[model samples]
Target: MSFQHTDSIALSELEGRAPTHSDLESRGITSSKEKDFKEDVKETVADSPVDSDVLIRDGVQRKLGQRHIQMYIAGTIGTGLFLGSGGALHTAGPLGALLAYVIVGTVTYSMICSLGEMTSFAPISGTFPHYAARWVDPALGFAVGWNFWYQSVTSIPTEITAATILLTFWDENINNQKIYTAVICVAVISINIFGVRIFCSTAEFIFSIIKILLIIALLIAGLIIDLGGGPSGERIGFRYWRNPGPFNRAGLVESNIATDQFLAFVQIFVQAAFSFGGMEAIAIAASETESPRRNVAKAIGRVFWRILIFYVFGILMIGMLVAYDDPALLTDTGNAAQSPFVIAMDRAGVKVFPHIINAAVFTSAFSAGNTTLYSSSRILYGLALRGQAPRFLTYCTKKGLPLFAVLISSSFAFLSFMRVSKGSEGVFEWLVNIVTIGSLISWLTINVTFLFFRRGMIAQGIDMRKNVYHNRYQPWLALWGVLWLSMFILVNGYAVFFQWNTTDFLVAYINIPIFAALYFGYKIIMRTKIWKPHEMDLITGIPSIEETELPREPPHTIGGKIAAVLF
Candidate 1:
């Protein structure tokens, strides 16, 4: 039967023909339900009337397409793979680092699957925060939304900081560095203010072209170097792997997997995770697309292959070309003069290519910062919609963009300048730490929300297996993501607290207490309780102004058939 949003589905329509609790119980759908207990909750939401006369201003025009989606994914993948892989390689050894990326990518793929199912069913601008409010709890939506906002704010400076450092590759003058960073930030903010389509389309074109070209060049150069085409006619051919021995020199020790290797692995994992972080942006964009269900499903399905090919293979090639033990690889001594990619090109005797690569690195950092701004602002808009934050943030411009939310979110970029004044990298490092924790929280929440969502579906006699976008191996995939995130939080969270010679422990550990305070604090203030399926908001099921006018029959035209197929 086709699904349609109508005023109501009569109880008589369900009547004796409805799937009873015993039927679900016999199918072993027990959780919070039991045999002879009250009947299972229905899938229908309460028919509460909204003030239809009141209009919530529609934000920014929705103009993005499949190309925009593809480019956003490419840009996110490029950021970490191109610049961050060097650090990961140094930590885990070539083999260990490769393994870590593959493992993380696999976990990410699973989480995306869960997210895809939900997004397809209910594509909206609010995305996951809205889902959390509807299917989980309002407090969860608040916490997740604000946490992501903070992350985006902090990342602005982090990316600018990266841009400043990268600038030193060609010019060591600090004055020039400051000017360039300011210009790039202003440009990014302008693009965002203009509209998401403009920002997304520009980013998609530049990033897609650059990333594809870079990958092709790296693959060709790596092959040539491996085949004895270097200055000394030496074939690199996996010698670094053997000499350093699969694991790093410091990591191979018998005691606790060696401090150097373990630290290296942890560091690389953090970077890899950061690089892969923006994949979730696709879910956010899914809301604005013309055919969200099909586009979102296609995007999520491509993630596994994208991570493996773009991240895994890209790092493998980089490691083979440059030995992990090279002292230059460790030059992150707070100096931008020492990018591993630039260093590798120099070592390979390609004098001019290093400059070319440096330029690309600068653009990549700016693009990351730009996208972060867009994401964080959209989340703020989501929060405002749920009455978690101030209502003014819900204001949208004629273009349909949430102008106030974007401005408020962009203000966080000013905080990045504080890093310049302090002359201490501590602020920047603290920001990164907080971003990591926030990401972990988001990951955990998504999985937990999915668990409840799936259970609710079964309880209401909705067979998810029959849905177009299905999540098999239910609680297992969600459970794995949660477990991994928990382990990361425990290990990394405490590491921030107990660092041997650092005063930033409190700053780093502050996110946990802050997150806790927000969650419980909002729960009390809002008087929100956990939700059951039947009580969920059902925002997606609510008919839009346009949809409300259409007849409730399956279309028969060729165009209609195509639209149905696509959606």
Candidate 2:
């Protein structure tokens, strides 16, 4: 993501034309040879009355602040970690789950580092999918952009459905689920309708804080439970691992300890990958962030801590408290009823904690859906800005909300309504099947794009140190990500192989062919050529971004310093 510097003043010569309010009207830059680029500029500048300009001036306000970006690193910790960890533990045992999460965490951090560099350098709203197009090939960008948008749209309903189930944990006799679904959908959309400041920054910041507090409380409770602080006063220290023996042999047909355990670990690895899926959503707010060079990198740097504390430690606590063979882990009560935390609490004979944890799970589901829909809208807005989607999606309200994109993505929330009644299960399953593998594909694209992007920077003689943000072992880190993930994705549904279930195999591998279709389809139809190293255009957007963003003000006062450190 870093560019080359010719001398000590890396950006001295980089300074170029600045954007002003008077430039709001069409740039009027017409180039028949590069019609797509010309049209992209027009659509961007025209976000409000006309296209995309200085982020503050129009088309998505530079509304996200330091706290928003800082808090948002953990913004999407949803049912996956809270509830799904139980399933992961059940499948892979304690040590296996921990190892799985550590592996994914490593890959996730590598990808994030590369992303931070690119985002710091460009700070474009279009984010990394577009980076694939610019740095790797346009066809790859087209595939990734559409795949990510579709993935986000589908995830909103999935969270809403989880929220409803968590609500039923409170009121089991509740019927006519549509009313509840509609209510949750409205609440999520209502937050975003007001604009980025209200929904993304303020709301998500609050959501993340609550989530962090809840997790810390749970971890403390877990420790107490492990130390026999519960009503039974039974010290349960690592006894479950010793008894069940640290491996479940969950789905294996025959009992080969080594082979079964290895297969089990693979299963949890896939789940762990999904758990860390949305960290890259950090880039979605690039344009709207006040100072991308400063804030975006800060947020990326903190991702490691979030993953360690929230996920790795959280799983450790679950494994410590809940045994792999705990029957509650297999329950179909369809709420936090099956959450390993609640399972642990129930085993400890703690009566009240389940209610508190369930409430948090409900909040988690709602928060995740809220943020997912917001991200989906922004990704669509990016797609439209890049001419990959319908032009109308680029339209923005006066508050810098991508009005049309929001509306379209919001419509997808209705998919949650399928849960209102029976008989739609088939269709719902089909929809979920479509985007099941989207996360791995997105991660793979980021690494691949980074490889090309790095090559381009070197070819142009750009100074690596001059990059707005620099992390060591980059191109190499990204290269490892690319190879490891390609193999990981291929074996994503390894269980399907031993069992030979068509639906499961398809669900696991569906995005592969879909991505290939989008890539080859676009290549054949548009006749676009892959970009050569020297031809990559990192310079086009950075100059305007640097000129438009407010000057960086380093934190000085104690409060500011504390905020900076925490965020």
Please give each candidate's TM-score. 0.83, 0.89
lDDT of 1: 0.67
Which regions of candidate 2 deviate over 4 angstroms?
A: 1-58, 253-255, 552-558
Top lDDT: which candidate number?
2
lDDT (10s digit) by residue, model 1, range 190-249: 888988777877765576667667777776776786678966677778988898677774
Q: Put down candidate 2 lDDT per residue, 241-312, tens digits, no spaces.
A: 897868778567575778888888887777888788788888888778887778888888788888898898
Worst 10 residues of 2 by lDDT: 5-14
Q: How far does residue 25 in candidate 1 sit from its true spot (Å)?
A: 35
Let me know the TM-score candidate 1 reaches against the reference structure.
0.83
Q: Against the hidden true structure, what lDDT does model 2 obtain? A: 0.78
Model 1: residues with Cα > 4 Å off, grouped in runs: 1-60, 249-267, 333-337, 422-425, 466-468, 471-473, 493-504, 539-567
Instruction: In angstroms, give how far residue 165 of model 2 lies from its true place.
Output: 0.9
Among all candidates shown, the one with the greatest TM-score: 2
Question: Against the unseen true structure, what C-alpha lDDT does each candidate score?
Answer: 0.67, 0.78
